[model samples]
Target: MTFGEKIFKYYQQINVPQDLPTGVEVLYPFDSTEVADLTRSFYMRYFNDKRPRTFLIGINPGRFGGGSTGIPFTDPKILEEKLQIPNTLDKRHELSSRFVYQMIDALGGPEKFYDSFYFTSVCPLGFVRDGKNLNYYDDKALEEALEEYMAGEMRKQLDFGGNEIAFSLGMGKNIKFLKEFNRRHNLFKEIRPLPHPRWIMQYRLKRLDEFIGVYRETLAPFMPDFHK
Candidate 1:
């Protein structure tokens, strides 16, 4: 089966864990017909091949970006402008999504970059508390509650035919958490951590080009004919 088929099936089966902390709410865009359609379009267009792509797993979805557009790391603007997958979601930008698309452009556009790399998240889902975004690790209780579910879902993603090497999108807590998950599950040969796009955009805006170069360099070894 093509990667898209596998991913679409996975999406249809995932459900929000019922035991979330009292204030935490999960984002499930696939419940929306418009988002499901757009997401299916994006996946089928770029990931129709049966090839095994490398995985770049981030912390979790941001309600404004992937949660809204149903595509990991992609915001509405990038959805329509870069991938040309039109959507009715808000046009407000997301910092992580901006840096990601820019890095994708540097790495040779979406078609080529996405052809070789698949983006998802450690949680494969996102949370919000009091109407604001929340990371899975933000609350200790949430972290503990998701321990098993996260591992199982990650195993499912690995079964989607990714290469042995995986990239952890955030350099700090996310990488630390993913390492534990890997140690327990033996998920990948290596989980290389990158400065997350949100961190680069938020704290290191001046080094945008440098971070892009870092991403380009990390991918160079695995990518064929990559630009130096």
Candidate 2:
């Protein structure tokens, strides 16, 4: 099987629990093509295609984002309705799923981008807090447990990959994790930092053009041939 298919198949077997199902208390577990797509991107870049030159990383899966769509920063509603990908979920009330779907539209759709670049996260599981689905900061114990799993598995899959440039969304904890991953394992040649698209769309719509402008530049040197 191809690398992408292999990763997708493996995703089908993963069984993380959905502790938070509603309000802010739902920690939806990972599942489906959204997870399959992101994880497959990691392996396909280096193993199958060997042509992907860039990698973008997020902190972890949000209940509505990766947790539901399986694709990082993906919106559940659009992912199902527009992208024709079944969500298999409707959890996490405060997630940015809708916003993410809009972002994909603004960025020229999924087929345009997923053809080349890749998106992923430091931690793959969803997190929650005192009756609230917190962002990456809610479940320390869960984070630690998943960290080992992600790293160990990625090491096997991404081992000594080529000169792929890496980018991280948001800052603080996510950057710290990427730094540690780079230092410990040297996954990519270099890693750049970018503000999460959610942050830009949330408080800085006017600045979104500028943000996308920068993203265009970053993606310029690494655009992939969708025709292939």
What's each prediction's TM-score? Answer: 0.97, 0.70
Candidate 1 lDDT, 187-223, residue by residue in tens = 8998989999999999999988999999998986777
**Candidate 2, pairs of clashing residues:** 20-25, 20-26, 20-27, 21-26, 24-132, 24-133, 34-69, 34-70, 34-71, 35-70
Q: What TM value does model 2 have?
A: 0.70
- Output the number of the TM-score-best candidate: 1
- Ten-residue segment with the worst summed lDDT in candidate 1? 219-228
Per-residue error (Å), model 1, residue 129: 0.2
| RMSD (Å) of each candidate, 1 decimal | 1.3, 5.6
- Candidate 2, residue 212: lDDT: 70
State how far residue 101 of model 1 sits from its true place (Å): 0.7
